[model samples]
Target: MTSRFTELVVDCHDPEGLADFWCRVLDFKVIDRGEGKVEIGSWVPTVEEVRARQMPPTLLFLQVPEGKTVRKNRLHLDVSPVDRSTQDEVTRLLGLGATTADVGQDPDASWVVMADPEGNEFCVLRTLAPQE
Candidate 1:
């Protein structure tokens, strides 16, 4: 059996603000909201709680008192464009407030390093494999 990904949770100081930033970046929407917690998801709501609970759940941004740090990231996401060129997608993400991070990749490499608004690192790659 294979497991399906329900969501990716990010810990941050400002949950709502971070959720808004990611929603804009990924075209995701807020599915659930609670005190110091915000969930954003890519899929539309299904059940009553998901629909009426007033919280987003695609990706959750949890509020933490400490500032964000990148000493190490156990998990990171790599995004790619559907039809647009990689260069174009990188430019678009940059415009959306993502900043470049120097990860020591060759200049000619197809993937570009970027950090989210909360300083979490991710990548925008040149290619995406076909969906199963």
Candidate 2:
């Protein structure tokens, strides 16, 4: 049998806060909440609905006692716009507490690097062209 990617767990100081920020960024909703953890994914009214649809992997935020100390993240997420321009999305994300990040990328790079409120690094890529 082949393996399928299911979820990505993020270690954060505040699961609720991180989940809230990510939900807004990804247009997702909270799927589950447990002690010190929160799971957010594509907005589905119920688990049954989620099961019925082919959904992307969910993000789980787990509360941790220690804060992030790494200057650069070993693994980061790259987001592409669905219905908006990359600049517009970057502005929107900045309004939501994401700060501009410089990761030694070239000045002409097509993607913008940003950091979330808790200093986790992520990138916003240029939107894909329409398929014929």
Candidate 3:
């Protein structure tokens, strides 16, 4: 058997803020909360695992020292709106403080690459049919 991919984790100085931003972006919820950690997941886990058996399968938002620069994102999320045009979504995100990034995409293209408030780059692609 081979290992499967799991959740993506992000390190941030403001855990609550990042978690809230991601919740807004993905329409997900803050499934778990702690003093210095927060978790966001697409779906809630139903099974309870004991001790080391638990997989801890959720995107972790860890608190770090203030004024920390994000050297590289160990993981990033690409977001696209479900029922809105990509242009509209990009506009909305920009209004929400996301800015353009240097992804080498022409300005006329259907997809726009943007960085979140913390400078994490994510792509907003033109709408395609949802995968089954």
Candidate 4:
């Protein structure tokens, strides 16, 4: 038996705004939208079609009243560039409302730590090698 990772839920102050930021960052589209939540992921498989095949986990942004504290997150995401250089992708993410984040990482760290508009931390790693 195997388990699949289907969704990553993010708590945010503004679900719609966060969803917009991530859509641009991931080149993803909004798959489902509701009063206080939005789901973004690949556009190929409609939400209803997701069960038919394996797919990357979708991001679900849910509205929350409390703001993020300065404490380090228990969990964070690390992303790698698929086609562009890491620096370029970091710049693009910055232009899309992400900001540099300091999380006690060593100055020589290879990945760039960044935070979304709502202050959720994620990392941009070096471009990954092509799969064989």
Q: What Cα-based lDDT does every candidate model obtain?
A: 0.78, 0.88, 0.73, 0.87
- Positional deviation of residue 89's Cα in model 4 after best superposition, in angstroms: 1.2
At residue 114, candidate 2 shows an lDDT of 99
Better of 1 and 3 by TM-score: 1
lDDT per residue, candidate 2, 19-72, as tens digits?
999999999999999999999988534555445664578899999899988888
TM, every model: 0.77, 0.86, 0.74, 0.86
Give me the runs in candidate 1 sitting further than 4 Å from their true place: 1-4, 45-57, 127-132
Candidate 1: tens digits of C-alpha lDDT, residues 11-32:
8988988888888877888888
Counting clashing residue pairs in each candidate, in order, gives 10, 0, 0, 0
Candidate 2, residue 24: lDDT: 96
- Per-residue error (Å), model 3, residue 12: 0.7
Residue pairs in steric clash, candidate 2? none
Clashing pairs in model 4, backbone N/Cα/C closer than 3 A: none
Q: What TM-score number comes out for model 1?
A: 0.77
- lDDT winner, 2 or 4: 2
- Residue 45: error of model 1 in Å? 5.6
The residue-by-residue lDDT of candidate 3 on 24-85, one tens digit each, is 77777889889999999776765433222545356778887765455545455677678777
